[model samples]
Target chain A: MSEFKQAEHKLLLIPGPIEFSDPVLLANATPGTAHTSPAFIPVFGESIKLLRKVLLSTEESGSQPILIAGSGTLGWDAVGVNLVERGDEVVVLNTGYFGDSFAECLEIYGAKVNQVKAEVGNIPTDDAIIQALASKPKIITITHVDTSTGVLSPAQHISSLVKKHSPETLIVLDAVCSVASEEIKFDEWGLDVIISATQKGLGVPPGLSVVLASKRAVEASENRKTPQQGYYISWKKWIPIMKNYEAGKPSYFATPPVQLIYALHTALESITAKPISERIDAHKAASKYVKDELTALGLDFVPKSRDIAANGMTAVRFPSGLKAPDVLPKLAERDIVVAAGLHKAIVTEYFRIGHMGVTAVDRQRGDLEKVINGIKEVLGKK
Target chain B: MSEFKQAEHKLLLIPGPIEFSDPVLLANATPGTAHTSPAFIPVFGESIKLLRKVLLSTEESGSQPILIAGSGTLGWDAVGVNLVERGDEVVVLNTGYFGDSFAECLEIYGAKVNQVKAEVGNIPTDDAIIQALASKPKIITITHVDTSTGVLSPAQHISSLVKKHSPETLIVLDAVCSVASEEIKFDEWGLDVIISATQKGLGVPPGLSVVLASKRAVEASENRKTPQQGYYISWKKWIPIMKNYEAGKPSYFATPPVQLIYALHTALESITAKPISERIDAHKAASKYVKDELTALGLDFVPKSRDIAANGMTAVRFPSGLKAPDVLPKLAERDIVVAAGLHKAIVTEYFRIGHMGVTAVDRQRGDLEKVINGIKEVLGKK
Candidate 1:
């Protein structure tokens, strides 16, 4: 119906919805298709299966239902709104900004939050978490990677602790930033609910959020999350539609974003084409290269230890006297965009460079080097 | 990262995501620019301005608040989640499917629903409505077009009636199928909230639902609707972001579908290129032609009067004992796809043809003729 135009910009090295390639971007401009079309159901059906496969789960053993929506963070509302009875006791693990945000969101929903916090860039110990669960947290919510502190909580380790101590507490891991960057292992990690997004490690544009739900999550949803259900986050209707649609009676609660799904379908194919090991390794390599360059620049790190830093992002403390406001605008003048820390505590102190969705080894290195040099120049260390 | 793939079908002409021209589809695929990029914010800003313009609202009197998410139906959720409080009275005029859906959805949000009934294909008179709203209602919800019945209600008339009878009640119109197909004056009609989506009149893909908010809608939203708010549907965070994103600070409640917006921006240009009046007239003329052809083929109009029929779609009733299912697959084999009647009473009695989007003019006319001739050929009608 119209001509699509491209904006003139150099690149986005920001965490999530990072610089997707031109061809990938063009995927969204495809002609809209009817969501219930015979051709669409299979493609959509296969996508949920592939998403499970990528998350290292299966329909039977994993039993985590998958739903595609417009935002990744919606997964939090889905989990918190469902499985959360009014005044349900939910233990929130305050690892960093996202964890706090999740707790605040749950509090809004009338959940009593018992926080088990760790130092901003450190992981909480299994014992510390077990002690917190003494209050009987109905839901144990944790972030896989906190965007602000660049901390990757050992979700697998925490899930193990919750299983042993609070056997009944449902576990929800916010994998919004980590799913594509590293191994989520939904089944292997015994994750009850895993929330992810297309933009982050998946390398697709922002819009679609993926939820991997266990049978427990669904069952819990039925008993705990009922009445006055928020329309935007209902997995109940979507589940039946997805089930019926694949079996041949396709329908929707609302109009499916056909073109974005086209792009996401393409993005999914790319992820599923290669083995998960290869994809994770590529992100690992990309992260290593960016970290090395920054280390060589003599900058301080935000995380207390390198092991705690997120694979998807490397957060480095800005030069002692320099703030992100000053450094970021200078970076922007050159058309290179990086992420400002989300937490008010470190928003002025640190900046993040994301390395997800890289097309080639060389391109990742090139973008990292450009960022490295820009940082150096800004700090007068070049 | 890998070769991109298009949707499986060779033809995607059902309805919604009608047919994105090549360049428009590709626009969404562009790399993730900083949402607050000097280059990007203006583009985002322009989209809001363009929407306000097309929806026929004054810029000063209106605020271009953008909320990015899935489907037009979410607009209803946004309005309810943000505006309709528990025990508040919401009047829903049910001319067709979405009107019923609006009533049902509002009821879910704890609103006391006053569902004003109308004949399946007839608009409820403004007088009937004003009498119905003798007691002040919190909101007046109506639909411009009923996609299920091919009926266009007198939406403007209802808005004026609400203004006269209950000035305090907000006027919320579901213009999902009528915004671009027909005229939807968001401001002039005193409509507080007008919801349309990408697929139908907008001439884009089916992923995003765009809603326009008048000053009153925003004012009403300031009142808390629910004890708990769904984050995805929360306008508190979204409205402020929309008002400020142009200043290079991008704060969105949910991760917006980036590519979808890009394609929409492109499609919007095409829709507004020709004056909207011409587009509206063309659809009206085309719909009349289809109706005439069906009448010539000895079929009755689904809606009693031509004036009641929607310009975007034409629903034609089949002869007695003629099932739509029997003729649909046969027509599909001949390369035309039409919608089956949604109401159970009309399921076997009627079928509908969509004439919106980039449907070739003669092909559309010929398609109607083919459907009519094909039905005649199949039923052994002389």
Candidate 2:
């Protein structure tokens, strides 16, 4: 097949469902292929294997990747249902709205959650996390990049600290906004689980919830005293099916989204073709360029420290006396779409722009330049 | 815009992930749009409105439509979490594998389940159903068309019986393989819930799970004394978001699959533009044509009675001494894809063919003809 061209439309500068490459979108438009069709089976199998390469997990590490037909929030349910029994204790390292929601999701499965809450645009410190570990929680969840405030927590550092303090605790990372763009050394960091979505860093349309679990996490689930309560989200039912698929044999627990899987296969192929370090560097450079331009216009960031900010997206507080109506429309008028603030306390006080995937990595697209120009024009920066 | 054209490939005759129309496929290839963009809000709102027309749910009936980014199985979880609280009794009419799985899902949510298992390709008799209902179960789950065995349950007749004997019992229909091809009147039948997927009769690639619930179902969910235990599948979290989107306001609990929703909008518009009754009739005629051809080749169907078989798909036993390996590759050689058997008891004894969507409704495409020719050629019946 030759290169496929995508239809032209407005640039999506929002956090997720970002601009996809022509090949990825074309893959999504494939004619319906049976989930078990030979042509489609390997597409799914290869996709699963490629997920490991993206996360830097080796086959020998016994890290299993799960791709299910749901949004990013479903990943939380998968973690909650598979790992947490009634009254099990879990520690949540809060960064923003997603951290609060993740804790609430775990609570639904009857988990007793103890959150080390961070201020807006910040993450819990290592000291606080270590102190929480003293309480002896079963799992510790940290949001790698909180979409609400664009805060990038130190997942590697936190995972190391958890290992040092509590050897038995499972380290879970919410990487919905960080997977393909961020530098995640799954094995090197001693992380147990990473929950993500297709729309954000993977550069595909939203639908599939991606989860990667280490051998220890799977063992914990297998040894649980109680039966997992969720039929769809349970790892007990899915792990074997995932294993069978990766082995090039078809197994069915549920019907997968065949077209979306094809898209994911193509996206993973593109993502893993180059060194992951290059992708991370590209995202970092693009983020710096955009942040530097915003700063030149005298804008302030939600994250107080530049080191704590995410490389994939930016959350900037609107100038005093300016809100969404005044700023968002001006950008819309310029044919760029940005997101409204999601932090509960400052819902109307700021806005967000995403610069991941093709918009960030494919510099020739000039997406960030257009977004920067639109923001400058809207704010009368000239 | 002029009519969109899809790429040519093999005819997909599997039970789902069926052939899609040009408009629907084009919609799926849409450039990334923000989930909350003004342009997208109307698309989502109109999609919800069109779903009502497809289900024959009148506005006065207060039937609420929910479109979530997940597979059809998620619908079962939605019903279990939202309405069937712990210790609640639910009766399942088991026509095939899906009914067994649905019962298991309800059980996962702590529902006490009683199943009336039908013989393969058959449904429970009225007397048996009445006897089961005598226990006054809180809910009755029925698979409208069991994809495993292609058995079509008498939903209207069963709904009428439930209304006469147990007026308060909620009736949920699993219409994953039946929706557009089968005739269903949600209001007239008093169906509390109908669960479906985009890949089947809807003629779109799978990703989105489509559900419609009655006002009574909504009230049952709302009046629950205990908090819902699911975060992503909770109706409480989804209902308000659905309400806001339908009212042209953007609200999000989790990100919707924006491109898939756009595809659903196009498919619904196409389905609704023509009289729905006409679409059902077209599917019926196509089914008759395919079934007659199979019978001519001395093939027997899983469903003993023709009336009990689904119009959208067929499950036919392999001739004695012939199995999947013997038959599947022959059809594949002819560029046709069919599904392997799914019913545990008959996993290798039969195969399934889908005739819904463009394959059945748009006769000019000759999809069924190609499938018929391929099957005849494979069996050496020329």
Candidate 3:
């Protein structure tokens, strides 16, 4: 019924599980590997190697850098549960929705959450951060691209500010949406931990979240006092497992998401071989074009400024009388997919255009045009 | 050069992430529905609907079940931490190794584990449990099949035994390996909980652990007074999330592993549509062929009794001097993969022949022949 003829039509334009290529899907179909297989260590190592490269994490910590399973939200729990003790003060920059969620999750783990406020388009300025730094936060957390509101805070500026004012406060960045879509210079940004998932940008299916810890973060993890975070998500137990198991010893964790790892392996090869800059540019081009087309069709963007809008997502606010909820299904009938807004801030008024993954690059022009035309046909442009 | 053709071969023969079909892989490639989409609730509904059929749970209790992400081991902790409060006395039947490991995980949550010991090839006699239940224990847990020994316990007999003697004592069965391969009658057996994974007989990749619960188990979960188990592995949160999200209100604890659900939806459909008895026959026949070919090559099965051996895995033990580790590489060289032993009781003496998925069904004759010939070629047998 659709132009996608691979027996897998259902183009996913919503952020993740983006239309994966057949080769990547084939890779995902590869058999499960014994965690202790001597041969599997390199595959795990190579995947981690590429993960680090894609995230631009060049730091050499004493142990393995990444943990394979669990979600992006749990990365905050992992960091909070492992790095922060009962009374530690944690600073969370709540530029948009996910930041507040991150703070609340940390608070549940018994850490005191200190929030710095900014709405969708606005970001925490250097002066605002300089004041928060005075309290001596144990670890500072920020979201580079708030997936909820399509806000892209300047990563370089935030990193520089943290390095200058709060030198001791280990900065952990939620780059779950940013990693594959935008440039993430982990080492350059001085981020102690960078969290990402396979779904976004990597063009693999969702299941695994890749967490990169700087040397300091791992050291902080060692000193964690609480009864260790549940074992499955525990990084402490897994690092030695990766080292010994990859080298053909007994595995610590049970069988990982094997097929998903294979898919991630194939997807990483595509991203790493080509410079990340090109991929980011592709996402930028796609997002910009979608914005342009939507603008011409008389829809407005939710973000206050184009410069601050997330490169991966173009959040559009529909006209006063027209609801995105009504228009979404009409497009779905034609096999065109887009994301609806998540929270109270923008649900009925907004819909999102995700410019991530291979399809966002390969078929962006036709897909964008179809979406634009589909919208106009449904609700005649004013 | 290695004989595994990266182009034509590397078919998955390992237990979980058991070889998936292209149709199912494309299912994952289907763009995602909004986690809260009206269509998605039914898709979620359809997934749970089919699980009830596959598990053969009580129709009334089947309507509300717990579906979670992450590894199968999480199921152990979920059952342990939730059902078990500190100082609760529980009896575990250790027919093979993983039952003891489940006991160990239960211990982490402060449940006192009194073990009822049984050998690998043997099932725990009713007397071992009868004596344990003499004092009215809190719960009785048993492994349905120990993948390590390629052996199963008489769960049907034991669950009924618990019901007759100690109806107050709850029954939990770790059906991780036996869920789809064997006829697991959750309702008839009166099991409080039945836990299994996506990989085994589910005809999909490994990433999910699907659990079916009884009303008593649900009631027990409600009265638990613990200050909540760790956040990441909380089944309490997931049970509600599944209902609320599927009922059209999406709550995010952690992002659902979207692709695994897609694979699961297709896999569960094939499982429920075909009668469980027919699926059991396929597994039994496939296992029989594997064992038959192994015997033709002059080998012995670790599980001496055919009645108790696992249909999914035929645990074959090599002769006195010939070790399993030596012959694994030979079969691996042929691009015909099999598993090495899981427990110390059989590690050096035995290797496993996994006949779990469609590959095991489709390529059984050729795959078994390759394994048989490879073993003969490696061991220099006639």
Candidate 4:
């Protein structure tokens, strides 16, 4: 759109650091702009407002968004350090590798973690979640879409169950892989917190950790009984900074990534220009096409059922005799890049393809088609 | 160099997020590149090696560099959680605001911090440091250049005193404001750790936290008595990831910031193209010119003397009957930007001007000349 063209490169069909738009990249190429400059203040403020719209949150909903310079994993630290005090009980609905890691992160901060782990290709059952809630854990974490196995947990249903069974327990959704591609109704779903990053569905580079906390979640962090165990990840230092920026004033706790923030501002402008539902619908349509094509190719999926599959990406088990080396290298030779399996349980049996952001919403790119055809050619099923 | 031109904006003369080169910005504009991709592995590996050269470290010196997606503040978390166990005795050589914040960060992780305080715009006395070393603290932290007051401590002299008085104490330097613009001999100066960020003298955007640790410092982190109090900031998870990238292998604990790494790679390539001392010398020359011009205008400096002042930036106190409101806005009117004071003790008495990276090294840009001329015009001294 800006008359700038990126150099030719392999199609990055992996989960994240997804293909960004030219305008977004151009914004990222911004010259030195002070974080507190008059020109950058509105950019930061507008980004905060746009994030609320993307999450289906509102001013009256009393939800606050925090943008920090870190990866999605740092979101785990933000939650672990800010909301959970030492010896507090936390329930983790484990779907795949991310669930185990999230639980591990919480445990590192001295949480007494209770995990409801599903099988390799499945989501935890409702019965297991309800059982875990009986203990009345202080917080319950759900990986909305785990990147490892492409397992999509039902966020709304889980939040409903938590509201009915343990209304006081804070609901934190790890939406790293699901945010823009999947339909999320934050306030309607009674969600308290959603942790995400820029590289996935946000259509920006990987440098920002975006988290939204409900009013109650903020109050909980403010009411912590002990001194914060970590400094950089503490909410106390960041809340004022966010409040100031959103108020169109310049403030600094730690330096914000100015260029990355510019990229995010441009990406968000494009994303929110149309109705967000339309974008989500486009992702849904793309997901179905890719899944249907893969199924027709006689491939099996990591998610046990189509309903539990992530719309942003898909994990397909290789044919019995084929492995990653047998298929991945061949695809690479064709200038297509996909990821090997990440779940430790089935690391060698499957591979993954991501269809999010421009890859999913911008059909003109034909990225999904390229991935499907590449897979077919590699498997000798063309 | 890449034929990419950034839009013109106000000259950023703040402490950091200084002016970046076009090539570095173009690199930041890179399209999607997977963190584990072979194409990205070498970029990351070379950035690590280049960081060593900038810091005067080497593989033979057993110094390892850790690059993470966070601000310079995150570096404190990495050191605090990894090296200081519960109730560990630590001494902070306080120069200004940064020293206080560093001590607070360490205390959050259960360190007992003893700060050797100095007056505003002054470094701690040798007697005070020697007396603090009598306690034989586990670590002694120094602020090489405190951005708040533009006070530069004598890093080599402090490390020498620590080595002579408390040989077991780990010497840490907070070089966030002085990594490339100032000389730091990591091995020869007996420094165990040097904490920095990308935006300062590295000429990249402010997203990546770069910290270099000597072998003994790495060992100290490895031998922590207590479990890590933080998860994302843990060295245990990051050491292997850094090592793998440096070894040209792909590994992941959390996703690295792919585009920022590309920018850092380009910036480091340029920074290490010549002897690092040349870059330091350029910063020195620029600093002297700015200081002399300000002095000719009858301005007082925040630093007590030129010998202890930082080469990357200068803090100048307002003459009687003048303040930031009287000068900063006028500079802004001329499209020249400088920062108001950050040190609380002199918040209304002074302002800061940065001369680092491209702004200091690329004289052809005439950035310094413009800043000097703008200041003279604003003060009606032209």
Best by TM-score: 4
lDDT of 4 by residue, B269-301 (tens): 999999999999999999999999999999989
lDDT of 1 by residue, A239-297 (tens): 77766654667776776665556666677777888888888887777778778877887
Query: Residue A67 CA error for candidate 3 (Å)?
Result: 4.5
Q: Between prediction 1 and prediction 2, which has the larger DockQ?
A: 2
Interface RMSD, all candidates in order, equals 3.6, 1.2, 4.0, 0.8
A293 Cα displacement, candidate 4 (Å)? 0.6
Please give, for residues A106-175, the per-residue lDDT of candidate 3 as tens digits: 7755778889888655787777888888887888888988877788888778778878887888888888
Off by over 4 Å in 4: none
Go through the candidates in order and give each one's DockQ: 0.52, 0.79, 0.36, 0.87
How do the predictions measure up, each by TM-score? 0.92, 0.98, 0.89, 0.99
- For candidate 1, the per-residue lDDT at A307 reads 76
Rank order (by lDDT, best first): 4, 2, 1, 3
The candidate that wins on DockQ is 4
Give the TM-score comparing model 2 with the true structure, all chains together: 0.98
lDDT of 4 at A108: 89
Q: Least lDDT summed over 10 consecutive residues: which range in candidate 3 chain B? A: B1-10
Worst lDDT 10-window in candidate 4 chain A: A1-10
Write model 1 residue lDDT over B132-159, tens digit each, in one string. Answer: 7898988888888888787888777777
| I-RMSD for candidate 3 | 4.0
lDDT of 3 at A100: 78
Model 2 Cα RMSD, 1 decimal: 1.2
Candidate 2 local lDDT, A205-234, one digit each (tens) = 899999999999999999999988687888
Query: Whose TM-score is higher: candidate 1's or candidate 2's?
Result: 2
Model 3, B173-238: lDDT tens digits are 888888888768888788888777777877766777677777787778778776554555566667
